[model samples]
Target: MSANKAVGIATVVMVLCAWAYIALSREPRLPTSIANGRYSNGCCGTIFLHDGVMTVANQRVDYIIERDKAGPYVLPTAYVGASVHAVVVKFDAYPLKLRLDDAAHPHQLELLDDAADGVRYSFTRVNGS
Candidate 1:
């Protein structure tokens, strides 16, 4: 094969290998159960995590959630640095991070502000949800 042909083949093979690796080793998916169902602060508003989508606000916005990843990544400094499902949402007020507290039982969650030193709320599941 000509030098150019050899180089072209090598490039295609490398690209295919890289793509395969990324596809095979993608981040683990978030559990729908942990954040699923109806949740509320009983003060500000409600959060719905149903059908693999999250829409939460005092006002109501259907936000599509993607890039759900396990953590140590999004956990606040106060946390014990354990791994759990975490996702970030961009809100009108501010960006927020939601972290699952318990992976075993998967009931409560932590809603944290975007601020480096920010407030965190323990959001609980509403009854019969």
Candidate 2:
């Protein structure tokens, strides 16, 4: 075979090998309580979680939740560092549970009774459609 043809065949083989590895070794995806997307309570401005960091915003103030991955998402309680209106506050292990209304829809996060910095509310994902 020509050098160009040999390189093309080798590239296809390598791609197939990588794809097979990913397809076979994939772990069962566990549902996460902390979703990485934009969420809204229909009252507050918006809430966003990207790459383990969170931002809480409203009409008046915007709070910053620091990068915290020290806790587990299994339990109903989680603790993290938060800054509410420039004042640092510790969210002392509050209840953070996930309520899945149906399998056809995304899970609804239920943060009951002041989960973080007096922001006690349940929020769902913002539908792009």
Candidate 3:
């Protein structure tokens, strides 16, 4: 075999190997799974669900609870009384900017797991002073 022909074959084989490795290792993208009537600010954020638990990236510790029938209804109260695992994904410090949402304002959200029962009930703020 000619030297040039041998080199060409080797290059092609290397390229094919790299392509296969990337294709097989890539993770699947999650889809938006919020119910038709429910809303969430974390929609624009990344969510991960494992072992029947749901977690959102860049979540705020102080979350507001609101009502919407379309939502699956995970957390019912604003205080977050349960002993749940919470983390502050992002913040600027001093006058913290929390991510707040309700059925009224929705965002580009993704649902990591559909089977997880993360939320329990739905409660909206009282109307009128």
Candidate 4:
């Protein structure tokens, strides 16, 4: 083949490879199976997510996601917790961060921070919740 034709083919191949890599490597949405349900924390408080709305202590908190820092990342793998798998979700109200308990429980949020320093909540999945 001509040198020009060969170079053109090579360039196209490189571009295609780079595009594929970028598309596949982008961060993924939080898994619904792990994000959906009711998690109880404290003596009588609960954090519930149904159809995308999160309810905490009977107050409905919507997903924030785009006030500049896009989030609500329920990544099955840790996004911000570092050691323990956690999600940096942006909510309309409190508890903007969440971490999982362990690999043993897939459908659970181990802990949450209320954005107020020293105020944290730990939770476990309520049966059938």
Query: Which candidate comes out best when scored by lDDT?
Result: 1
The 10-residue segment with the lowest total lDDT in model 4? 76-85
lDDT (tens digit, per residue) of candidate 3 on 37-115? 2223222323332222334443333332223334423331122211123322333332211122333343322222222
Using TM-score as the measure, name the better of candidate 2 and candidate 4: 4
In model 1, pairs of residues that clash are: none
Cα deviation in Å at residue 75, candidate 4? 8.7
- Show where candidate 3 strays beyond 4 Å: 28-52, 55-129
Report the poorest 10 consecutive residues by lDDT, candidate 2. 59-68
Candidate 1 lands at a TM-score of 0.48
- Choose 3 or 4, whichever is better by lDDT: 4
**What is the TM-score of each predicted model, taking all chains together?**
0.48, 0.36, 0.26, 0.49
Model 3: lDDT of residue 80: 26
Q: Which ten residues in a row have the lowest lDDT in candidate 3?
A: 120-129
Full candidate order by lDDT, most accurate first: 1, 4, 2, 3
Off by over 4 Å in 2: 1-34, 58-89, 92-95, 98-107, 115-120
lDDT of 4 by residue, 1-129 (tens): 999999999999999999999888744444344556787654535667664566654455553211113333332222221112222333332343455544323455644442335344466678876
Write down the lDDT that model 4 would get: 0.50
Quote model 3's TM-score: 0.26
lDDT at 14 for candidate 2? 100
Instruction: Supply the TM-score for candidate 2.
Output: 0.36
- After superposition, the stretches of candidate 1 with alpha carbons farther than 4 Å from their true spots are 1-24, 58-97, 114-116
lDDT of 1 by residue, 1-129 (tens): 899999999999999999999988855544454455776664445566664455543233433222344551122212211112332343434333466655544466567644466566566777777
Provide the global lDDT of candidate 2 against the true structure: 0.43
